[model samples]
Target: MNINDLPAEMLIEIFTYLPEWDFLRNARHVCQIWKLISTSPILRQNVELSKYMDSYAYPLKYFSAIQLYIKKLVMHSTYIQTFEKHHQDVKFENLKSLHITSKVQCTWWPNSVFNNFFSMFPNVQIIKITPEFWRDAENCLYALSQFSIIELDFGYYGSNSFGTMGKLHDLHYRFIQFVQCQRSLKILKIRASDHFAEDTVAQILEKCPTLTSLNISGAYVSAESFKISTNALALTEFYMKSQSEFKDGDLEALTKRAPCLKTLNIEGCRSITERGFRHIALNCSHLKKLFIGELDSNCVTDVGSDVITKIAKACPHLEFLSAIGCSKLEDDCIIDLTSSCGSLRGINLNGCTNITDVSFFALADHCPLLNVCEVRNSAISLKCAMYLIQHCKGLTKLNMSNCNNIDDKNDSELENMLETQSRNNKPRTNSSVNSKLDMSSFSMHCFHSHLKDLDLSESMHVTRTLATKLTRILPDLISLKLSISADIESDEEWFQEIFENCVCLSEFKLSTTTIQRQDYLKL
Candidate 1:
């Protein structure tokens, strides 16, 4: 097929997948036809007028040319001055969505900025307001009355500290009063607020009938905080994190409330245990993604793993499961999970110390389609890792960092050998060894041929030889992470040599080591 023979529609579809419109920056100058397509209104529909646009003198004048094409416009802090001046005149009549984000301080915006900002996009369907554009409660209430927004993301920007002032309740009430009138709101994500509308949940239920995903994670909402009406029972994905009063029965009760909820992320509820999660598995069997990980503490014990086993058996469609810091999960739990959930795709068992080689064997025997697996800071040895590499050939991302027991051993040579190879008494061949004495050829040559992202950081086992042996065989490796393990002898050249051999290495990280940024330039 000739390069220029493809139709314009097909070419436009291909261009949409290209990385950040880089090709068009110069390709527009290639030919008249290309330039016309590049500058067309259809291509410039979702334009972002960010701080980088300051590089141009008159961004407003530039945007005015494509006013008819403006569908989604993102305005950052840099465009604030020019925005405030000519926003009323800049007419994007067909604008459907508007995104406003900034990392500037709470007091950065002029009191009238948001009021004026909303007036500019009065009829936009979707409005995303980052926490940076905060105004006084009085100004906020009057300014937002114009927008009939369907999707609203009024959340945090890590800037505002919702202080524990004497008027805390007043602040909550004011917030509710401001947003309660948004009857057409469909999706609401409120972040970094300790109090999620103790009294306003009913008002929201009344106002927003089509609410689907409610992320009150930053609100610090408790089991007792919400007074959800029956009208608000249509939520699909509900995420509530960092609750002080979250108890064990919340899930059992929550399933009854949001019966159709597909994804649940109750992350930091210290009071929740296996009992509630079991109920979640039994009742909310339609769950696709469950994140009940106790990030700060190892609160989700074997009971939680047991509940997960129930979830695997009951909810076979569970795609992504994260149990980070659930330390008590042993090999049997993994066995049950792998056996029951043939659909298991990605699992994060980081910080689970009780898991070992047994889970690896079970996963290898079952779960052929499993792709992303992270077992960092676990008791799994490198010998079992040999089984994983050879058996779980489909895995794209594998993280076994901090498995200190995985010392520089070629046990994987025999450990990972196929059953047929062992019966014939044939040793694994290492034909492509550049130099027999090369330290890179120390570890077993080629095992995980399909792995793209590998993290062996903090494992004293991956010495100079093992790193070389591992890198030589893993031809598909794109991103690699390595850290200096204790007592492992290595020089700067060894590190350089390992990287030089990886012709496809795209993302590299060498942490807690003497490797300098300049060494990367050498490769």
Candidate 2:
């Protein structure tokens, strides 16, 4: 059947499959029949498009192709003026998302200029305004409150005057009062200069009862005195980073209040203690992931252990736990963890230096279903780590960083699965059915094919041959952390070769002082 013969609904279905920009452009060019169907009010209600403009070759040709796919477009400072060069008969009503950020800061942008910029898209529902231009058009933000916005990322990049207590208070109060109170604001991301305004945040949560995701990263949460009692009944995800103000009882009270929280991350909240963790484990039963780092020394003691142990027993569904830098943990506490919460899927014991090989073996014996383990800085040698890996066949991710004993030989046998092409030759099939796979041997690359992420940082004995073997065998390797190592320097070229061949890598970290950014960026 011809395109014109299809029904509006069928055409929309086809068009929706096309990206936002392409769909709009394709619809506009078709006969009036297709245009009407594609441009109908119904089709425009829920769709969003983001068109990118970068300084590559063929600006005109690129813009033409992009204009066809452009639903919402972002223009950097350099590209803003150039967009008009490729201007066509496109309507402002067709656009849905717009972001304008520049490298150079603008002092002042008049209200008319700002209005005209957004006037291009009357149906805008998502907007991101950077601090680079916030000063120029602070009042422009007041106009944004009118849109049907559901997602907003507002940045305020000003000089750091967060030293004095009085200055911080005033800065906090000003922005808190300035945030446009929108009932429809469901996802809000803000970068503040000083501590987050507890009262203001509370007000925001109270107003937006439907808010599901909140990210307040790199901010001092002075809500120490201001109790964080969430009114966001629909809130599911909350991330608070660098919460320097989360002293002692603050986090404990906050978690107790957020009973329905599914994901709570207070990364770098140094003030949080065992009391806070205990509070969360007890109250937030639905928490799927909890990342509490930089706990105080006192809280890592026996008192903290008792609280967390109770929490582990109470919260039966805890899956991912990142208690990094909690040095108070001993084998006893780990034993309690395995016994109490046997259902754990992933655990990160990055800086729990007290944990030995014995502690991990205990975990391996108890938590058979554990798929991922990150024990970066502990007493577990390559020998004990290999044992744990052999037992936990289901594991795909492992971390043995700072464990000085993880030599090249010890690493190979830990994960040594074979990856072979299927009958079709195009597809690869991995098998654990081989009988010759020795579990008793202490080899580093024992089950290599099944291994996805491996951290052997500070394992000084790692050589070029071992690194190459790892990359060749482990086709699914996603992350490899080998920082502060002696072997990395000896075979720098081999390191490069491995990274180049490991096509599936998404995250990587190296601590060599000599490696350049271009070298790592090749991955």
Candidate 3:
């Protein structure tokens, strides 16, 4: 059969797996059949023009081909100028979502520029503008108010300076006006320095009755400011990160109103203590993903095991939890958490040095569906690693960096097997040595094929022999990191053997103390 004899549906399905840029630049130009399949409505439903924005004239050519079929468009600032010069009258009637990103500030453009640009997409329901577009806040907000966008995500990177207090107040007033204009608003995310006042949050909750997701970061939200008159019944996801003024009282008030919240991220909110979590347990029983990591904070002593015990008991459906840098957490809390929340798939306990092997054992005993586990800089021992490998069969990604107890001795079983095989392969005399087999030529079975990403960086006991055994045990690794303490001399052949054994490996990091030779650098 000829290569082109395949059905058109099959060809289209194959082309769907290719990257958008590759389909546009290479696959579409192959033949008329391929071109027609590539430009089909299915392939052109979501178009990303940011890659071609680097060249001034390239995006205009591709835009002409897929403009009518594009339901979602993502373009950079340079494409705005290209469109204005060439295709201003082009109407994207099917476009529902539009994402605009700018490398530099868009202060030079006036409100009329955005108004005219947005007029082309008459049916756009979702608009996401990066922070650089907010440098000219008054004009941008004024232009956005003209349209009734259902979802607005003013990107998380906030302005470094909001000018004077008077200007900030004016900007806040204009922002509120913009929110009031959107009658069907459902999702809103904004990260501006002190941009949302106490009443502003209350006003949004009361006015946008259909709002379901609200993310306000880099702002000061106190209990008084976050207070609302009625319940936010439709709200399900609330994220208020890095709000230093947000205390337990504010969390209590907010969770009381937004009782249906399933995903909450209050990371870096140092003022929120165990009392805040107690409120979450009482009100938000449907919580699934919680990120309360106090990254780099020295004052997280208040969030101890009591907080985790309450959350684990209340929220049994919790799947993902991140408590990074919470130094006060111990093994008891984790044991209680994993034992209760059997549905947990990912947990980040990085920098919690007090947690010992007890937590890992608990995870292995209860959380069979665990996938991603990070315990970097912790006190976990070899038993924890062995238990996780033996019990958690579905585990994929594991980060054990700076874990001093994990050394080459963890692979003692495999080492013994290798020594036995070597003795059997040895030649009886010097004449038969020519037929002797190398260790790398042995066909070792893989113990764990599901694990794709493994990090053992800064582990002092990782020798060349142990690393070679790891390649055989986990042959399907996509990313592997090893910081071996052994010398690097005459190790080029071993590295080549690793690449040959782990055929699917794409990213590998190896570091040693001794200086590497010139030939070893090539591998």
The lDDT of each candidate is: 0.65, 0.61, 0.74
Q: List the candidates' TM-scores in order.
A: 0.77, 0.68, 0.84
Cα lDDT of candidate 3 equals 0.74
lDDT per residue as tens, model 2, 239-290:
8876777755766666655678778787676666666667777678887777
As a whole number from 0 to 100, the lDDT of residue 415 in candidate 3 is 62
Residue runs of model 3 more than 4 Å from their true location after superposition: 1-34, 51-55, 131-135, 156-164, 196-198, 228-230, 296-301, 413-446, 485-490, 512-523
Name the runs in model 2 displaced over 4 angstroms: 1-77, 80-104, 160-181, 195-198, 224-232, 295-303, 339-343, 362-372, 387-396, 408-448, 463-475, 478-523
Taking all chains together, the TM-score of candidate 2 against the true structure is 0.68
| lDDT per residue as tens, model 1, 328-393 | 777777888888777777888888888888887788778877788888888777667666766665
Task: Give stretches of model 1 more than 4 Å off.
Answer: 1-57, 93-97, 103-112, 132-145, 156-184, 195-197, 201-207, 227-232, 296-304, 390-394, 414-449, 485-501, 513-523
Pick the lDDT winner.
3
Distance from true position, residue 338, model 3, in Å?
1.9
Instruction: Indicate the TM-score of model 1.
Output: 0.77
Backbone clash total, candidate 2: 24
